[model samples]
Target chain A: MTRKRFVTLTLIPAIGLLATLALVSIAGAIWFSVMNRTLRSADYEFVGLHNFLRLLRDRRFFNALENSIIWEAITVIGTLTLAVLLAVLIFETVKKPLWRNLICFAFLVPVLLPRVAAAFIWRFLYSPSLGVINYLCGLVGIGPVEFLANPSLALISVAVVDIWQWGLFFTVILLKLLETLPREPIEAAKLDSARTWEIHAYVTLPMLKGPLISLTLVKAVESLRSFDLIFVMTGGGPGTATETLDLYAYQMGINMGGRISYASAMSVLLLIVTTMAFVIIWKAGKKWTN
Target chain B: MANITCKNIVKSYGAHPVIEGLNLEISDREFVVFLGPSGCGKSTMLRMIAGLEEVSAGHIAIGGTDVTDLPPGERGVAMVFQSYALYPHMTVADNITFGLRRQGNSRAEIAPRLKQVADLLGLTPFLERRPKNLSGGQQQRVAMARAMIKTPKVFLFDEPLSNLDAKLREKLRTEIRKIHMQLKTTTIFVTHDQLEAMTIADRIVLMRDGQIEQMGTPDEIFERPRSRFVADFIGTPAMNFVRAEIRAGDELCASGGGLTLTLSPHSFPDLVAGQKVELGLRPARMELCGQNSHNAIHGTVVLVENMGAEGQVITNVAGAEVSFVTKDFRSLSPGDPVTFSIAPDHIHVFDPETGRSLRKD
Candidate 1:
């Protein structure tokens, strides 16, 4: 076979499978969203824009939107900040390869835990009476604290769980990237009288801009679509305190109300926003790196 | 005021000692080149002076102040690295003034000084471009401009031209000397390139095995090498060595391989009869001569490396090949007989085992 023909034949299985799965699901969703489809009443009628208009007036949908924004913002910022801090600390301080690798592995153990398993683990840790965290808090004279129960702390508490899993995973990646970065500029900054913090803030962080932006976008998308951690930990509990858009859409369509068309509309909205964000971030990163 | 004194400086990595008990004094505004083979302690010594590498046991004083514990910036020294480590995201202007800006100088305070240094280094045109956009030579100038703008008491260059092409290296070498002449900073440059050391250094400190092998001016080093390593490391078409034996004649003479030369009696006063020595002859010092000329050696041409201005002719003499540079363009091919003569003073004598020059001062 010609090289081009062989390449095309090799790519067809993966490309064709992915394209078919995505197109069929999106077409089905679009079709269902325009009709008043419900599990309770199977005889559906075409009702254009009616479900979308219901979403516009739905108080639960607005509450889920607010919760998702807070969750994604806090989670992405916290994860990225910890990644930079830990990566720089280890890169600068840890001398031997054996120690560096061991430290990184300890932080990475959380990533090996399944998200559902991690949710259960965090739920126990946040328990007011049985948790060792509360026991330590008592030593500090602070709490029998309601970590997952209080309305103001529920989303942040869950966001911290996501941060714990992803932040260290990215720290290892950033540390490897730091190894590839030329260290002479940092040394030159030292001779320029840059304090240690100034060198990292001005020189090292600016150099890592491209990778950090890409990580930020990925973390944003992952936090927005997160559902299992909240499901196992709070079940969007304490009166919808941790109900993100993903969990709200699922609960509205499947559990509490069988409004499948409305959930499809919410999925479509999420897809559009994610694609726009990815393109913008990718473009800005390209401009900066080049 | 910026004269440097290093007293018994020693550097070690755990137990591996790199520099051991090295002591030297550098005068204010003196340009010294640390010349050596790779793995010699030239760069380590330079770093010790810059306070980048801490000396294990020594006292270092700069400008009459003990700066052994000071940082590089606080020691009033700046360095141009081998790789030209300019901040990639910063523009030429920003990089040049980074030192002043970091020291809390405002933009308006540094603008006039930056312009002056940029114009001095011919970097005014590239002041706004990033380092990635500039050529290798241009980036090197930016590194120099960064140092020059600081107006420090000492300038340390660690093989700053090793990355450039030949023509660019030569150009920058001359420009660096000119900068030294103009600024008169106490400069210490480290390079394994002997030509670079020869062209730019007011004094060459040739090092070997973590110690000073020889130290002198360029002409003193070339004319009177104190050891075999200095003669070999400091010349292009390096100085040739031939085994010889000292003989008692009317005066002391070195005779070997159908060649004999009258040695200066004042130079080799310790040499007795039947002493084995190595006769060192520079290729540039030997001249092509006629068959019957005095102090001439006869050989068969083994190979000829022909350049337009000058060429090196490798000739076989008594089972040893001796090469010499000749400006005499003749139609010479392999298997042809050749004769070359050397002046009596140009013949260097060294003890074969110790490799130390026998010439007494």
Candidate 2:
């Protein structure tokens, strides 16, 4: 066979297959959202904007949207902040390489565990009666406080669990980036009389802006679509306090009341929100880098 | 505007000692260049002085105060790194004024100092631009501007021009000299380039194996090196070494590689008969001579290098390669027999065991 024919047959088919899969997934969601469809009945009708309009007015949908936004915001900020602090404290300050590696490895235990396993472990720790956290709190004279059972604390408890599981992800990535930073600028800062905190603030963090933004965008999107931990831990407990957009869509579409069309609409809206978030971060990253 | 002093400074890492028992003193406004090859501890000495490296033992003082234990910011010295270490995210103005801002200088005070430094380094136009937007030379200038704005007691430069091209290195070398003259700050510059040390330093401190081999003015170090290492290290194309045995008779004669030459009576006062020594001869000092000329050595030309204004002739003289520079290259070619002569005063004798020069004067 000629080179041109081989290239056309091989490359085009692979690319066409990927493009077709992506296009179908997106087009199928939009099509099902616009039609009155159900899993139980074969008969259906085109209902323009019915599911979206109801979604806009539904208080439970609004509550889930707010919870998702808060969850994403807290997870991204908390994880990044904790990751940077821990990486700098453990990796940069520790002089012995063996000790540094040991500490870093210990901190990465959560990441090594499966997400569902991590959720189970955190659920046990957050147990109000027999958990270590409440036991320690009891010793400190504070009464046993409900972590995942209280309406006010359920969302935060789930967010904390997400932060614990993923903060190490940022720590490993940012630590590698920190190690690759040119030492001369840091030494230059030292000679210029910059204090430790000031050096990190003015020189180190600014240099890390590109990687930090990219990581934040990635983690933000990941947190937005997160389901396994919240499913295992809270399961939208305490009257929908921890019910995020992902969980809410799963419940509406696949669980007891299978409003498949309405679930498809919610998923489409979530996709739009995540895409918009990614675009904003990407644009901000480009602007800062340039 | 202050003197700097290092007393018995030693730096070591783990079980390996890098700099050993070093001491140096620089008077006010004196420019000293520490010259050595890579890994010779010149940079380590400079970093120690800047308070960036902790002294393994001993004390350092800037001006009159001992600053050995002080943090780098409180030591009152500024350093320009070899990489030019300009903050990539900051504007030129911000990079220059970062230290001043940290010192709590208000905008009113920082503005003029920033402008003055920018003007001195010709960085006024690029004040608002980031370091990446500038050329290599411009980035170097920004590094200089950053260091100069502090106006500390001393300036430390760690091979600041090593990263630049030859032409820019030469230009910046002269600019640095001018800045030193204007500021009159006790400056310590470290470099391996002999030309840079010779051209810019008031005194050159040549180091080897973590200890100072020689410290003197450029002309003194060039003309009268204290040891074989100093002679070998300071000259371009390097000085030649020929193993010779001293023969004492009515006239003292040194012979090596089938060539013999008479030495001056006072060349080595402590010399004894049958002592083995090494003779050092600079390439530029040897001259092509006729076969019957006094102190002439015969050799066959192996290679001829034409260096525009002058040519270097590398010749095989009695199984030893001897190179000399000469302006008259018209009659030279490979395989041609040549004779060269060196004056008695130009010859340097070193003890073969210790590599120390035997000359008393």
Candidate 3:
């Protein structure tokens, strides 16, 4: 056989499988939205753009979209910032290897636990009464505060749980990247009379830009589809304060209401949003890496 | 410029001792090269002097001030790492002026110093480019410029040219010497390459197994090595060692490998009859001679390595192999008869047991 035939034969199966899965799922979603379709209905009626029109008029859909944007912004920024700071502290500042390992392992415990379990654990911790958080607050003379029960604090509380569960992912990745950074530049910085903070600001942070951007992109994409933690913890309660796009889509199609066509439209919109986010982040990552 | 004094320095890792009870005084504006094999702790010694490594026990003083406990940043010294270590994110100009800026130098002061270093290192055009954008030699220039712009009391180089190619190493080696002459900073350079130490050093401190084997000027160290280790380490193809017994009579002589040599009266004055000694002859100092010459060792050529301007002729002297370099290479082939001669003044005698040179000089 010719080389080109052999190469084509070898690559066709893998590429075909992935392409088929992606095209079929996307095409099915678009088809269901364009046609009047329900989960239990036997009849399929063509209703062009009816579900999207209804989605445009839906206020709850806009609220969910806004909440999702807020959720992604908070979780991605908070996780990355806190992870970088903690990683630096554990890896650079803490010289003892034993202590570094112990601290890293402690942070990794939350990541190892399932997200639903983490949500439940945080739910108990954020309880107004009989929770350790309020007890600690009582010691500081602060009254019991409703964390998940209040509309203002509900989204933030859920975001905090997500941060707690997934922040270690960033920490582990960034820590590995930090370990591989060239030692000479840091030693040079030290000999150049840069103090600890100055070294981090000028040398360490600038060198970390590539990894930071890549990890930010990862975390942003991951948080966009976040559902399990919110589903377990808040359930979009307190007047939908913590309702995100993923949770609203699930609730519309499978939970409180059965609006599969409307849900398909929402999923298609989410797909577009995610694709745009990934493109923007990828461009930013390329610029920084260069 | 300032002198550096290391007194009874000791460095150990847990139970393993690296540098032990070492003492050396580097005069102001002196360029000293620490020459040794790998793991001799020469780099560690330089690091100790730069305050990058903590001295286990001893005092290191720069100029007249004791700086044993100070951090590297406070030690008033600059170092060029083997890897060059220019900040990849910063421009060449920023890398050169980073120390000055960190020390809170005004922009006016920093600009002139940066410009001076850039011009000196021929980095003026590439000042705006980052380290990754520059070539290896350009990055090395940035590293040197960074250290030079500081103008610290002492400069430390940890095998800075070992990473470069052979041609680049030679070029940079000469450039380093020129820079040293222009700045006259008390500099300590650590390298395992004896050639680098020989060409660039005002004084060569030869180290062996974490201790100072010998220290002297290049000529003194090369011509009058104090130990067998020094003689073997400081020369290419190394100095040849022949085990011989001293014959005492009206004139002293050493005989080994069926070859005999008469020793000068001033050489090994305390030698007794029938004492075992190792005789050292540098390959470059020994010369090819006609057969049956007086005071000559006869041998047959085993290998002739023609190195362009010079040739290394390895010959079998009795049962032992002896090699020498000669420029008069004309149709020399293996299995040909050859004779080599060494002057009495050029011979080095060492105690067989201790490897200590017995030659008084």
TM-score of each: 0.98, 0.96, 0.95
lDDT, residue B349, candidate 1: 88
The residue pairs found clashing in candidate 2 are none
Give the docking tier of candidate 2: high
Backbone clash numbers for all candidates listed: 0, 0, 0
Best by TM-score: 1
TM-score winner, 1 or 3:
1
Candidate 1 local lDDT, B286-315, one digit each (tens): 889988887888999999898789888889
Per-residue lDDT of model 1, residues A60-136, tens digit only: 88998888888888999999999999998998899799998898889889989999999999999999999888899
Candidate 3: which docking quality band? high
For residue B251, give model 2's deviation from the true position in Å.
Answer: 3.0
Ranking by DockQ: 3, 2, 1
CA-lDDT, candidates in order: 0.89, 0.89, 0.89
List candidate 1 stretches off by more than 4 Å.
none
Off by over 4 Å in 2: A1-18
What's model 1's overall lDDT? Answer: 0.89
Q: What digit string (tens of lDDT, one per residue) describes model 2 on residues B1-361?
A: 4898899998999889999999999999999999998999999999999888999999999889999999999988999999899899999899999999989899999999998988889999999998999999999999989989998888999999999999999999999999988888889999999999999999999999999999999999998899999999988778989999989798877998868887876867787779899999899988998889988989999999998889899999989999998998669999999999898888888988999989888
Off by over 4 Å in 3: A1-17, A35-46, B290-292
